[model samples]
Target: MFVSTPRTEASILHADLDSFYASVEQRDDSSLRGRPVIVGGGVVLAASYEAKAFGIRTPMNGRDALRLCPQAVVVHPRFSAYSDASKAVFEIFRDTTPLVEGISIDEAFLDVGGLRRIAGPAADIGQRLRERVRDEVGLPITVGIASTKFLAKVASAVAKPDGLLLVPPGGELKFLHPLPVERLCGVGAVTARKLHDHGIRTIGEMADVGETVLVSMLGGGAGRHLHDLSWARDPRPVHVGRRRRSIGSQRALGRRPKSAEDIDAIVVGIVERLGKRLRAAHRVSRTVVLRMRFDDFTRATRSHTLYESTARNDAILGVARRLVAGATPMIGERGLTLIGLSLTNLENDDAVQLALPFDADANGALDVTIDSLRDRFGTAAVTRAVLLGRDQGMVVPMLPD
Candidate 1:
């Protein structure tokens, strides 16, 4: 008789770059190494471990961050440099395993199952990955290994700033139950405070309260979600080459009031950038969304859906302009501090029917020509008249298609 045995050793690995922007700064300049570094002039985009030791954090106002650490070195962001470094690190990740799922530009989940015969244990593979990244890409990365994706992600967060950890099989609960409820997935500020108020402070305590009780306290969906996470019941696989659901970009404008023309130019620049990215990824979207943030820290969104999907800038821009016009009344009421644009309901270009030659849009050819020129010369080779002398904002980094 032939018998089959299930394999259950921990094989999922989560790899994350530590303080990505700040690490890049320390790597490139020797003077910045071992010193507190801050990466942005207006908002604190990233802070080095040295700076974090002084109670500094990201997204804090640069002025207030200086108050925390007066000697911290603040540098203007160089998007080009950070983009290049991210590409280099991802190349190393793909070299390690074929099953790499990128969560963002700075982190990914890798499945290394069924490779023990060729590559030894999963822990050995993770250690080698860390070594290669440090030697080749010149950056520090932390890695966590566990049986499930959720546990692996939590383990990585626990072991950060250049460290590695692995949770062995048959010991998942002993390791998980001791952690705070905040360490579990789907437990944000509101959920954590609610759990604390109910005298459930730890994952073990939450588990003891029973699912029926939890469901009564929190809503049905959230209560069920937290209960399952308390037991580490995740079954998600590490997917490779997954396409992004939507693509978008945004810019922060100062508090100083400006005319409507200024806002219009910013919208044009954002639309052009997003359209380029959409076409480059070979995807088209049917819905265009406009997101705004006011000086009072309140936010609002407006969207318009088109009859057909398209990747042309003019087509997307037409929809975006109408959305902005519709929200102009709200913008006038609240002072605008930030504005963003997003494309959703995405699909592959080949999924749509092609237009006949006689009915083809001229903008399609123009898009191709501009993309080629930017590829050969530079992104600045061609630009709209309105954006010629304007600060078009930085191009945010994203995962590869």
Candidate 2:
């Protein structure tokens, strides 16, 4: 674990949108102003700040969000529009600095260390970036300026919803010490509860526990990680040209007890779509991961590494089916409510080796042919039988990629 040393020089900047999807909807339709807005049907995909004030959040049930804010307006997702807006905002970042590392569609870490003479100081650059995004893209963005990537991220989180924050040199500890322990990266509910039980509720308290005690309490990796962050220490550089390493999808089925057949069908649909995306990107995945959320909200993940990397839908779906089967006992006891699929261990298309001798290439060839057809036509032109009538439509625009 490494703690970042505060420096007078600010180079890294993190930019993030404020209630991105909801904000976009509000911007497009002025009538939604000051009213709660929910952006999904089955799930409360994204909620406006107004809805959030009413205790609504993402991954929540749409029905519950409506109950919280009965006057809230619901809207379906607009992916193409969001993607266009993202491209426009990213263009602004690129214009300012060449070393912009995108974390998601709406957030990125910009390294402007080499732009002092040309683009002014980091603080000024951040201000300009925010204004540009608002004026050109019609969305509000918050920015955090710091000397390191971790501090920049923390700074951005602190200054959200159309705000800007700068952590000056030698002020890192002062800014971090009083924050809740749960605010630290990787300190989820489980870790926060554990820390609170030990009377370590704040970052400063965690720091006082010392590295040795944290290691003993939280185990080597997690303990060391918390200890380092407690001191406002992070050394990750803002690197450019970072490519996505995985493609995945998840669906929340609320508290409903879906049957094994239903779960299998959903998992198959997710894997099929994900495999198509992998092939579109000219990549192959050697690992498949299955994530499940039970009706009681307890979550578990199972993963399997394939004998070789491949982008075929059948191969990926086969592994996913096996993972779902293995989790059947747990599902029987708790009842499954949500399912997810992710393909990892990715490699470039050129890196994939052909299948071994005696294996039929028909399936692979058919997958490629299907992909080409979909590329020429639309995504709707090709759909799995399970997904044919499942036109719930996109509930909310995901963070643009």
Predicted model with the maximum lDDT: 1
Q: What are the per-residue Cα lDDT tens digits for candidate 2 across 59-97?
A: 787888889889889998776777777788889998988
- Candidate 1 lDDT, 57-165, residue by residue in tens: 9878888899999999998888788889888888988888778888988999888886788998999999999999899989999999998888889889889979999
- TM-score of candidate 2 to 2 decimals: 0.93
Count of clashes, each model: 0, 4
Model 2 global lDDT (CA atoms, 0 to 1)? 0.82
